[model samples]
Target: MSTAQPPEDRNTLEDSLDALPELSYSMELVQKVQGGEGGAMDELLERYQPRMRRIIAIKMGAKLRRQIDVEDILQEVFLIAFRKIEGLELRSKASILRWMAKIAQNVMHSKVDYFSAQKRSAGKEVSLHGLAPSSDSLEPQISAGVTSPSQRAARSELQELVDRQVERLEPADYREVILLRDYQECEWDEIGSLLERPTVAATQGLYRRAHLKLRKQMRKHLEHPE
Candidate 1:
């Protein structure tokens, strides 16, 4: 008689299998790019531009978004990506996408820093820390349950660990759920369209499952770190 494997064991087996990278269209273009085919680079830019734009828009705060154009930021990101592409060790299509996303985030952060400095220099800076929290405000507090700087740092590190695990998730769809829903903050409908799901409900379900899986993985990692 065959006995059923536990969920965790089954998941581990599946993840091990899925960890092997397969050659995809994006990977093919990356190879062409490495071979000095300039057209491949343009094709990659065209393929990923929309998604990169959405990520930039979502990550750019309201203050920066008002002062700078998203398209300009995107252009800068693409240029940086192009220059750095030669140095990248392309592991998979997801790795390429993640590399571009990291570039976009860095560009957005630089813009935010520039504008913030300008505001300070102009004497127009506002201090939100002096004001009381509003009922509708979603800003998290460092003192609610957190007491020390180390605790805050630990929380931040934990968040980063979770994000890394999400990026490393097998079956690219699972990774897309976290990227779209949590990182990009895309609407359920938009996620459905991007993922080609039948409906918003389906996208929501995918996000929920992916989130739970991530949480489980984090817990296991914390309990038994390698």
Candidate 2:
């Protein structure tokens, strides 16, 4: 006959798993990386690398500033974030996103500062900031380029008009706001968690405003198309 497992052992195992929360587990994984978990550390970096790259793309306006090499910024952001992520207080994924945003902002600022210093050293105003991408900044950012007849005709055209307006957003900052709210059908609370906003209502309003702007822009695109 086998001996019965102790209740306390089962509870302890559950608690350990619970520490890795499903809601915003990415944030917890980052925390674990700070605590020196090898697997968690690697996963965290891999997961956000693409996102970090996209943020860099928008910040440098890669299309216009062909020389910016957004990857440079991604490296810088990761190095800094790896250092400071532990200090951040993330109650949800929204909070985690805001933390990531802060890191991106700081990385861009430092790049600006470095370039400005270089310009001063050379006695010229030729700083290394990139120009913004065009309204058609497709490819990796706007177009995952999913092909289907369903998205090929009028609907595609209509959606492309809306997409242009989205690119005009605060340089890759609010992509989650659009993707989650409209594309993924995420609820307002989930959005608020990612954005660090105070309430679900606030997130809803943010999405509502975006939708209104998209509609206005879509009408204009259809009217012109030139």
Per-residue lDDT tens digits for candidate 2, residues 49-96, read 544444445445543334455666666777777777668776644454
Q: Which candidate comes out best when scored by TM-score?
A: 2
RMSD of each: 18.0, 13.8
Candidate 1 pairs with clashing backbones: none
Q: TM-scores for all candidates?
A: 0.49, 0.53
lDDT per residue as tens, model 1, 102-167:
787677766666666887999877332211111001113422465577865655454445444554
Error of 1 at 6 (Å): 20
The Cα local distance difference test for each model comes to: 0.58, 0.51
Cα lDDT over the full model 1:
0.58
